[model samples]
Target: MVEALDLALGGVAVGILAWGFERYRTRFVKSDLIIAGALAVGLLIFVVLPGVYDSIGAALNIDGRFVLLSMLAQFVLLAIILHLLSMVRETNARFSDLVRNISADQAPQMDGGERTIFVVIPAYNEGKTITSVVKSLPDTIRGYTLQPVVVSDGSVDDTAENARYNGTVVVEHLVNQGQGGALKTGFQIALEQEADIVVTMDGDGQHPAEELERLVSPVIDDEADYVMGSRYKGENKTGNGVVRESGIRSFTWLINALTKSEITDCTNGFRAIRASGLEDMKLTEERFSAPELIIEARKNGLRIQEIPITIEERQAGETKKPQLMYAIGLTRAILATWIR
Candidate 1:
């Protein structure tokens, strides 16, 4: 009777081993099928073979000390095996949940009807190209709704006045605070108006307005929290001019190298970001160095992606590259962020 009971208990361990093998077979196969196979063999060696040996020992009246020790060994082995099986199952389940949540959270939510997108063009003396850039964007990206805003960076020229006339909501900075400040103003206004997505493009018209779809698709499809247009991603490449282009490439290379990240066209100002992603970005710089924005996004654990975009020559305006102190200030800020 005692022998029969021991065999029944042994069957329970075998049953648990079988259940674990079948349940986690796919995961085990990923690591090594041989390890999984070894588990099966070990189960037979420790549980099934032991039960047979114990039955013969009990029939021959084996010593009481040996019998007790054998029972204890069986219990300990069963417990350890079961614990290891549970751990693998739990770990895999946890990893799957994290991936699903991250993927789901990044997707852009669609509106029931026409969703409003506010395009913010931060302009600083971009009078010549402002009009063309304003007129170039179509009514929609494929079929999403859109609205454009021209945030004048205290342009001394007629950029602010012209943007208002070209069917845009023009906001003016009393004093030039730089591109980052202009973007902050535009984003705040968009958020106030309940915009679904807010796009920031260069007022200098270097961004091809016709290809706005590429900038907005990831947001519409829910792939990323922010999407920056990459002139290096595809055949579509545009820039302010040769000198400006070289500067852009050099700065981009510097950033990519420091971050150990791939940023094909880092300096392209053509980007579309979710209103949520801009919720708390301070954007303190009043100059042209906006790499701080990317740094901020990374620090906040935002999921950022890039889309290939066509870079175009400035349609009708002068370039606004910072010459001396502004460059120095930007370098200082970037280094500080790295050290921090």
Candidate 2:
């Protein structure tokens, strides 16, 4: 009866492994699947052929049950560690790519002398909305020539093509880095072009192009080194429900308390900064870049101001970020930036 129960449990474990393998095969790399398959096959052999398992245990002078349990624990632990290591490796590779891409070449210069307004739009798979967003941008903002730099963060769709079609200079990542990484790449290019003021807006149509002047006015007028757009203070329209709104308010309170600044909106991405002010700032948050930038800017004693602006609904496609996950990430980013 005991032997039968052990076999039954092993069978259930194998069944679960098989189900997982089938369900997530497409999501995993070929090498990872191969390793998982090999482990499953070995476990199956040890469970089905107890005599072979005993023979191996006897050779090692250990009980077969003990040997089996030890091997199982070791295999599970090794798989977890391997998975974590793979994540680290991938992250490191992406960081290396970001550095390489940023230093590769300077973007094409704008005509009519030195470009004064550099707009950096960071996009993931925003193919559908990118063209419209780029096209709607004014050729000039407040008498300064507008130069749009679109950083495609490893988009698998037609995002890069659409930006190019709209005549914006494009920089692309070979792998998907989060919004923050894309912005860093775009900012570097903007600075390289010797732009007086660098403005950042989402590639999604949520940020109105007509508001571009308002967003950058503080920087251009030399009133503030960094200008952050505030949805609460302006004509704002958000589709986010109660839970998200509450979370935003809580985060805003925490940021204000820590930074000793009264910011109405903490996560708005539509903002502008003087190119010179960014020289000493070190921004490292790839996912929570907006908050990180605010924290870093405040820390460096840069003049920060918030301007009222309108935020419209996204043009197309679902938001890539899950609400719960985004909240957690933003919280983590806020804490990380504060502690750092």
Candidate 3:
């Protein structure tokens, strides 16, 4: 009987392994089939053989009826394992999607600048577009010094390798934390590296590296504590078609109206901040809405300025927006920031 219980527990462990396989093993890997075979073989050898005969059963102190009960136990264990696997896979997939979506966002650049600038790019699963973004940075800016950093947010792809090859300070997250989390990490590194000004950009290649100079100009000129890259002020020429342009126009108008701070594009991730102002704010967000950094700066009486910047369509892959969720989240963020 005890031998049958041991066999039952062994089968249960196999069922748990099957659950993990279903959750993380790639679809091409048929861990489920291997798990089933293992369970069957284990049960047959350890539990079934000993219970087949009274002579051997008594010698082993395992009853035939108890072995049957243990078989039922194995079935229950399998069912529980399957349920757990489904839940784990669903949760992990959702979290992975959130980080991937954030990583695919693009950044803007300054043409030429006279102030020291550090660009922090937060990336996740941006293997296809990072090379172009990194290579596109101008070798020199007239008025600003530049350091481009690519923060790989635990990408399953080769984002980090590409960034390193491009000669950027590549920071990697050990796990998929989120965009806001990645930005904080990048900023801290920039601080330690002693950057006077920091520019935050997305990794999906939506930003023009040349535009960074303009975004940082206000800070270098002492006109603003922070400078935001606004798509509205520049000539209406964008690689984005009419539909995307129209959407951006509507969002810009909404941001200007609600914030009363005259931000032409609050959702745009491309922006430059002075070291002092950025160091003062507590960057708590761990997702895409690091928008809180700007809001908090403004609340603390830090000057905010916007500069005209050109926008471009992604070099490859698709936009990560699932639907109207980004818009809805923006509205909530605006309200939250206003109250704060």
Cα lDDT of model 1 overall?
Answer: 0.69
**In candidate 2, residue 258 scores what lDDT?**
90
Which runs of model 2 end up more than 4 angstroms from their true locations? 1-106, 109-115
At residue 14, give the lDDT of candidate 2: 81
Report the candidate with higher TM-score, 2 versus 3.
2
- Better candidate number, 1 or 2, judged by lDDT: 2
RMSD (Å) of each candidate, 1 decimal: 17.9, 9.2, 12.9
Model 2 Cα shift for residue 333 (angstroms): 1.2
Q: Using alpha carbons, what is the TM-score of model 3?
A: 0.61
Question: What's the CA RMSD of model 1 in angstroms?
Answer: 17.9
Query: Could you tell me every candidate's TM-score relative to the true structure?
Result: 0.61, 0.72, 0.61
Model 1 lDDT per residue over 50-164, tens place: 6655565677777553474476568767966886797786775455334323322332343445687889888889888788778887877766677888877768999977776
Q: Over the stretch 1-340, how does candidate 2's per-residue lDDT look in tens digits?
A: 7578668757865875776587566676655566556666766666777677788777777775556657766977888798889889788867755553653264675554665888899899999999999999988877888888998888999998888855689878777778888888887877767888889999999899988888888887889999999989997676778987888889999999999989989989999998988877887777789889999999999999999999998999877888989999999999989998
The most accurate candidate by lDDT is: 2
Which stretches of model 1 miss by more than 4 angstroms? 1-114, 165-167, 235-246, 324-326, 338-340
